[model samples]
Target chain A: IPPPMRPIPCKPLFFDLAGNHISYPMDEIEEKAGTSKKSPKKEGGGITGLVKGLWGWGGK
Target chain B: MTTPTAAQQKKEQEKQALYVELQKFCQSQDDTRAIKVASKILHLFPNDEVAFKTKIVCHVNRGMFAEALSLINDTSKLSGSVQYEKAYCLYRLQRMEEAKSVLDSWQSNSFKKVELMYQIHYRLDNFESAYDSLSDLLKTSDDEMDDERRTNLSAIAASLKLAGSSRRVKDIQ
Candidate 1:
């Protein structure tokens, strides 16, 4: 058996719609987009919240 | 008992009609039409989960991950599958760590989750773990393994075996 490998710190590579491989600096993108710091608050409430609670049907 | 006002009845009928149209569009896999109907429904009922989910699927199918992510972010409450979809968007965007973190946060046993985990582990160069995940997935009944999934498992297995043997040969040399 091959010895266990250590996890390497590497950036992930994404594919575009054209099936081209592209590398992105996610940390910088997140920092600039403000997603790295905090998530946005969800909108609406009550019946909307209740309705939005259903799962696994159309979104699959 | 008080009867619904004319306007209320009209609104209810419209909602029902929109839902019917949405279902038809989705069933036909007409994502563009489905999205349009879903957006209309969502506009009228912002919290409609089915419409939101339909819209998300349409965006994802079109490879609009950024749009899908944005929609997921706008939602306050996420259903299990929606969370999975969000993680998938992250994974497709090449935010592997973020994708892993999201999947980790959710205590799900979905095949999609397993597949995503396998991909993430493989990309992270954790071949052993990746192989283990793929093995677990393959162990699912043959009926559950579609042609594409079976092919993917075989390909990953071959790649892992090639890597392992090459490493061993280097060690021997």
Candidate 2:
């Protein structure tokens, strides 16, 4: 059945090494939900990679 | 106890290497090859938790619940718990009572668990409890999820009403 959409999908939950339950990461969740923010057309050959790299450092 | 001999140590090393290959296969979505590598690891070490789980996941992903259940049943112990997965397999197999009991065994609540319980209750024609479960889900959820669950709650309510009406009609008959 196609489940109702949520902040997270109602699926398997796993534990981290420390044993705290964790759901799927946002990117994987988005991808599974077909609502990914990634552009369909790749932006340049590698420019998007560079931007994501910069964002990962600054955003965190 | 005697220490593991060199041959046993070498076998352990090979198992570790196969696990690495299994990881790569899983990441690449090569579940077929991943299952083979995981089976190899399991052959070398039947008590391997990672290999057992990887194999189960591959089968579950393929919708081969029976195969996954076989693996789960054959193993006496899994280093990591696969209780939830076992419930899912039973649910898919249409063993509602078994599935419900497995879920009931859980002490804590999660969205998936509650949702599944709601489904199981609905299938068993226990509309009242199904509605209760959905309402519980509705109250706990927030924002985007709340709307969807509210809709589900109403649907379950409708079912509850329908079941009541049917019972009333039966009494009249």
Error of 1 at B136 (Å): 1.2
Instruction: List the lowest-lDDT window of 10 residues for candidate 2 chain B.
Output: B164-173
True contacts kept of 2: 0.00
Write the residue-wise lDDT of candidate 1 on B24-84 in tens digits. Answer: 5655777788789878878887776766776887888778999888888888664454777
The TM-score values for the models, in the order shown, are 0.64, 0.61
For residues B78-97, could you state the per-residue lDDT of candidate 2 as single tens digits? Answer: 82366667777787798989
Candidate 1, true inter-chain contacts retained: 0.00
The Cα local distance difference test for each model comes to 0.62, 0.62
The TM-score measured for candidate 2 stands at 0.61
Candidate closest to the true structure, highest DockQ: 2
Error of 1 at A14 (Å): 14
Task: Give me the overall lDDT of model 1.
Answer: 0.62
Model 2 docking category: incorrect
Cα lDDT, model 1, residue B119 = 79
